[model samples]
Target: MKHVVFLSAISLLCTLLVSADTVTNPPHVVQFTIDPATTHQQIDNFSASDGWSMQFIGKWPQHKQEQMADWLFSTENNTKGQPKGIGLSLWRFNIGAGSSEQGDASQIGSVWTRSECFLSADGTYDWTKQAGQRHFMQLAKKRGVDQFLGFILSAPVHWTQNGLATNTGRGATFNLKAQHYHDFARFMADVVEGIERTEGIRFNYISPFNEPDGHWNWVGPKQEGTAATNAEIARTVRLTGQEFARRNIDTRILVTESFDYNCMYRTHPYVRADRGYQIQSFFTRDSSLTYIGDVPNVPRLMAAHSYWTNTPLTDLKKIRQEMGEVLRAHRVRFWQTEVCIMNNDTEIGGGGGFDRSMKTALYVARIMHHDLVYANASAWQWWRSVATGDYKDGLILATPDETLVDGQFTDSKLMWTIGNFSRFIRPGAMRIHVTGRNNDPESATNQEGLMVSAYRNTDNSIVVVVINYSTDEQKIRMNLHRPRITFQPYLTDDVKGNDLKPIRTVQSGSVTSIPPRSVITFVAAQ
Candidate 1:
């Protein structure tokens, strides 16, 4: 039997929307949809864009040459809808500080080539050995990525007086003495300028420190990391910016990638005990951390890592509201720069699945929704774009031998999920408003509940995404007040039939039922 309905109808009304009926409390399938023309619930103007980056492609085996490269650089279309590397907008180059130059325990073994921030003794800041990073940058350029963000873990050891890589000691001490600030800043500016001179491309932004709020033990030749206080971070940016300006280098700076929003706003040990300035006080002219002058005017982005803090959506919304008021007051942009699951179970499929898992995909979508809708972060980058571990957290996986992981490396489900947003909603796209029944939609559903994010395209098309977090089937109905044109809904769920493949698009404005724990993208093509 075949049924056909005309595209144009006088009044489109969908009824009897069957939803998950719970015995104790029939799960009231919350109705969520959009009215792009009149709805005023536009919370934040930015929905931070998401993407992947690499720092250690050279660690892969030669036989598998371009194995990861093929997926990220090749043009062949895989199982996913988009090309291998067409959906990303930003590429972060993890610049090394010459830790590879050290022998013994100083050298990071295995997959992640973790090295200290700076070079030691010999004072060698060579640009020749960073071939892997250089190669990726070229690929990113060839792929037509919009912006390139560069971040370093630490400064060189020769620049520090303590003979260590980090800033851990009594009373917020660092290897770089009070007088050596200029040298350290110059070294950083030099690296940026050198990369430009050698690679024919200039980095737009540089994040000098990574998670300055956390305490770590990189001692005894096992690892390389130093502690840095908020005050020191402000000072470093001031000096580095001056150095870069003196040399006429245009590379900008994004300040203090704090562990989380708490580190940025809350008064902690480094900000309260060790230093008398609050982290947010740096943006103001009255505070002591204001030594860099009006921080809002600087080309630096107020940044932090979304670790240990972005779990509950309600709290995340409250934090965003408070931060939004502050950012609006200061006239500065915020960014969720670095984040990854080091702890077990926090990240989906992160336990030991070398590739990205369904859990990881859902969590990522939820996190992105919160960041864009609540905090209005300008950009969001995963901690690491590529990893060859058994953990299912990376966007794509490749063995050192260049062989694709047993599964299809090019079109992983996680890749498709990320592509659903990154490919369709491009950079510079303003985030419009979309409302739902949940108090805090991002919070109510994560990997366990329902989640939704909506955006308006440059072509005037409205896109609404809904993710059901429950294991049971859900039926949802979207209501329109003064409806104009019809809406086309596309669903991507775990259903087996071709009608319910990854993306099942429909052209009706009726009540639709969604599968359990699935992601559906609805585009109202007017």
Candidate 2:
């Protein structure tokens, strides 16, 4: 049967609705029909990057580092049954580009932003250089992180054309010297192989580029990055795949890592030639110079970031729709590999201040919903899992200072909001069909209130996440597979102190009221 809509005649009488703040007018009801039989992409994982922050934080006192890791990667539950941590399934380890080794002479102003490269200038490998990063990687494995990915923002300084990790004076040109392509590939493969041999952890996926499309100038005093054309990306990925094969490494190469979704679909007028339209450029048969679809160790997957593409709400969905169409046509899966609040997020007065408010959490939730549902992104990963700044970047925000060992570390509302999905929806879960939103199943969003998405685990359990963005309380009627199904709601709102606290249990066929300006996860087990 198709999805159906329902409204009770007594809905007007139930108008005395209680919101998160106070009693309000009777809230309107939205009937949500979740069909598990109809499903889409199988989620790979929900992940976050350690980036360069962990190179220092991981070196903190053993107890201090474990305290932070438990918050980000722990899956155990407390005595009250509330989750102990967000339980991230995947952890992205940064494969540095040697900026840190050069110190202040590297021209990268910030010492914290620079990453220590494993490949020394003498073409020798030092597996112990990134001690802080390796420390966290091992901790994640011990804590049950399911997958590990190694991502690089730039090639090592030794191989770059300008002998610098940042960018060359040549605008929009790839920083890597053409002669050192094979060397870079071999170095990355060596890092992967060395880590497996020494640390017993093999990267499941390796991304060769980060925003190769030149969406922004790679030349910055902030950190290391490189800009590459489609041809450059294709060549680098092919070489890396070959090197992986030569090393007998089982790691899959993640491609593109476009700066934004639009770069994956259309060539922006501002970008370099053959740099954008990555989905069609590298996958389609006719993209002569940049086609690496048949490369040896490459999977049929593409990844892109979610920066500068989210705004005005309506445009956000449309851009992702276009990106999804191309992905579907090519029969390639998509991954939203990276995201951080780098926009004019006017809702909370831009992305400048560190946000502990529910407003920022909902703002990010709406984007994640769009990516998973609209764009069919299999993996949703945040940029920095931990940070030492007052910016809206890190899920675990710390006091501002480069080498500050420990002052104050707090979990933002964004952390619990992510836990609503990352903790409940584990790897191998499938995104099932969710309909009955204003009778239009095409749009999975509610525009202003109650953006709901459903997923089904392999064990036949169901997870429904509802983001109530409206001020007024919203009511939802879930038409589930069986009658009298039990579900517990874990909420992340101001009233809940940004903690993912479990509320009272409710059964199917009963109307559940979700508090406004909050994210609620309804878990119905088998």
Best by lDDT: 2
Q: For model 2, where is the 10-residue window of minimal lDDT?
A: 11-20
Best by TM-score: 2
Clashes of each: 20, 1
* Total clashes for model 1: 20
Tens-digit lDDT string for candidate 1 (37-149)? 33222221111111222334543343343555444334344575324432466767766654555544344453244543334456665566656567666765665664777
State how far residue 66 of model 2 sits from its true place (Å): 1.5
- Encode model 2's per-residue lDDT on 359-434: one tens digit a residue: 8888899999999999998999999998677688889986634455555577878888899989999898888777
| Runs in model 1 lying further than 4 Å from the true structure | 1-29, 33-86, 105-111, 115-125, 162-172, 217-222, 268-279, 291-297, 312-318, 344-355, 401-412, 438-447, 478-502, 524-526
Candidate 2 collision pairs? 15-26
Task: Quote model 1's TM-score.
Answer: 0.78
**C-alpha lDDT of all candidate models, in order:** 0.55, 0.80
